[model samples]
Target: MEFFKGDKIYNFMGKRLPFLGFSTILVVTSIVLLLTKGVNFGIDFAGGTLVQVKYEKAAPIDKIRDILNKTKEYKNSSITKFGSDDEIIIRVTTSTNSVSSDLSDEIRNVLKGTGNFEIRRVDIVGPKVGGELREKGLMAFVLSLIVIMIYVSFRFEWRFALASILALVHDVTIALGAVSLFGIEVNLDILAAVLTLLGYSLNDTIIVFDRIREGVQTSKESDLSKVVNESVSRTLSRTTLTSLTTFFVVATLYFFGGEIINGFAFTLLVGIIVGTYSSIFIAASFLVQLKFSIEDFRTKEVEKIKKQKEKEKMRAMFEQGTV
Candidate 1:
């Protein structure tokens, strides 16, 4: 089924500049926010204790914070409501000598008289381990990009590879920026989400690229712009259907997945939207700017013909000289 009807053509390439500008603004804003405000790194990467507590009744976050602050040891603690008002998550940096069990007990004791609560879970990460996790997370992201570039280069061409990589970067940057902007906690799970997004965006981009490749080989259109535009139009339905279904699922998870997986789902939600936009506008439009044409794909055949003609000319020259 087609999302767009009739034989009408949409000029997706024509408006690439504006779309690129918009993306540039988003990426820059994200970078600036990342530098200034920074990501709210969770216990997984920030070396801390995370305590999840569920109260019998809804509790005021400010009161909980006030109660924790009364104890000098817990004065610097950060308290936030988790999935619901009745659930609270408390985070505190781990002391050099404190054990995870001790930290949980201390937190429980501090808030004991304030409300009837149960400790659902406690997680601890030491400074050394958190540092390692942070470094590994960054490495994972970089390696994924390198692998994706290599795959795209082999599957298509260098220009397509570069375009796809740039588009992926754009999608990732925008997603991270959204995370930073909204003060979402960045953790291992969120990193996994970003990687998942990388794959999703790549899949969408490859579909468009594959269609464009086919159009170049089979379509009568000579203009690269026309070919790209037609290819995108033809694949519009598939792209829309895939993105919509994925978006719906991620949105559902975001709203109801609880605090544990909220970051993961949120990343996917942003990435899917940005990824779809980049595949349709940024990736294919970049090919037109690079002067990509059918000739580029037929370079080997053209070179062979040139060599054959040169050989014939040399043979003719030798025969004439001998005559």
Candidate 2:
């Protein structure tokens, strides 16, 4: 089913500047926030201990925090309810070089007075390991962009690749900024979500780029901007459907997936919205600004025709000589 009529045309290029300017402002604000406020790194990135416990009965989160607060050592611990009211996860960062076993024992003892609870698991990360993980996570993100740029450049053109990279960066920065601005903890799971968004955003972009490439090859329109605008309009229905369907799925996860997957789902939700916007506005707008001309395609077609004519003339000459 088509959301838009078959012959409908929207002047996306006409409003290119506004779209681009809005994206630019978003990206710049995100960068400024990232530089100044920074992300709230979770236990995985910041050296810490994570303890998951399940109580026999429903436990009030505030009481748990109160129990931990009795001990000065555990006063600053972060407590979050997991899948249910009986389940909770607590994280604490300590400068003390206590072993995981010791830390686990300390945590258990501190909460022993609260209620009968079972320790599901405990994880510990040292400062050295956390620093390594932080570095690698960043490297992974940067490398994904580099790889995407190379692949798009090979599949389409350098201009297309650059534009796509910028869009992907835009999607990621805005997603991360939203996370930070709202004080969502950044962890390995969130990092994975960001990487997934890179691919998701690129897929949408490639679809639009493919249509633009086809339009340039087939359309007789001399105005490259018109060709781009037409190309985006043609794919509007498909882009909207894909984004909406994906958003529904991610929104479900965000609401129902529990605390473990909350960040992941939220990241996907933000990425999908931003990614869809960039494909239509940021990517196509860049093509127009870059002066992507249909002349390049036409010139190549003309050369192919000239070569074919030369071969045909040579064949005729040979046939005449034989005669």
Candidate 3:
């Protein structure tokens, strides 16, 4: 349990300011990058054609891509392997602003191979659907933040509420910025992953805050910041171990979760790492800076009971000494 008997490093707390500064700088730089080079939204956001085809045997992905690339009809198309290397999905931009059944027939003709194959699915999403999805995703993210703020404020205090929200926003912005930087396609699944990360990050923060709260109640003689530092130090082992275990699982998904869940797991991996850092350095440190006091911690009824007990102990000691 006592992984770190004393503080791991005597002057470890001083590095917090520099860490905060670097995080702030990175966030600003990411924002600038995003503004200059916006997110490359996938076909799920921008409307396009979708075609899923399965082969009897393992198909040559490069050959399929070459076929799409050489075809005059789908000159500007993005081809990807879904499910497995044998299953191919293609998306082609509309030329005449209309999605015709004839277009699917053309794609089938181009994809017609020597081996046995089956067209599994085909659908065309319009710009209207993309717009609606974008709106809904925005609403979901905004609603999640609002709910988190309300819950943290009601459960803990306003300072903690603000700190947790800031951490969540930081995690989200970084994830989005990373996806944009990598040209990863952001879709409905990715948005769902983002929401899940928000909850996961907040759960880590709440656990650390709860530990700090416990320290404040028990360590009456220690400074509030010291109490917080101790609490975080004590929970560091649990935090690191939990994150590593989760990371291994998510890393597995990232590598082999297929194309569909890969983006989701990638988002999760980044969120969990950053979430752990924020819980320790940002969230707990901000609470200490906010002057979280033991007095502010206890309820009025508890304080009254404590004072009555102290008075009774003092009276008993006085009577025994006089006798």
Which one is best on TM-score? 1
* Model 2 stretches astray by more than 4 angstroms: 56-75, 81-87, 99-105, 301-323
lDDT of 3: 0.77
The alpha-carbon RMSD values of the candidates against the true structure, listed in the order shown, are 5.5, 3.7, 6.7
What tens digits encode model 3's per-residue C-alpha lDDT throughout 98-181? 445676567667778635688878767777788798988899999999999999998876887887888888878877778778
Better structure of 2 and 3 per lDDT? 2
- Give lDDT tens digits, candidate 1, residues 64-153: 888877876667788888878899888888645644357667767778777888898988888889999999999999999999999999
What is candidate 2's CA lDDT for residue 81?
A: 79
Which portions of model 3 show Cα errors greater than 4 Å? Answer: 1-12, 53-75, 80-88, 95-97, 102-104, 113-123, 289-323
Alpha-carbon lDDT, every model: 0.87, 0.87, 0.77
Q: What TM-score, computed on C-alpha atoms, does each candidate reach?
A: 0.89, 0.88, 0.79
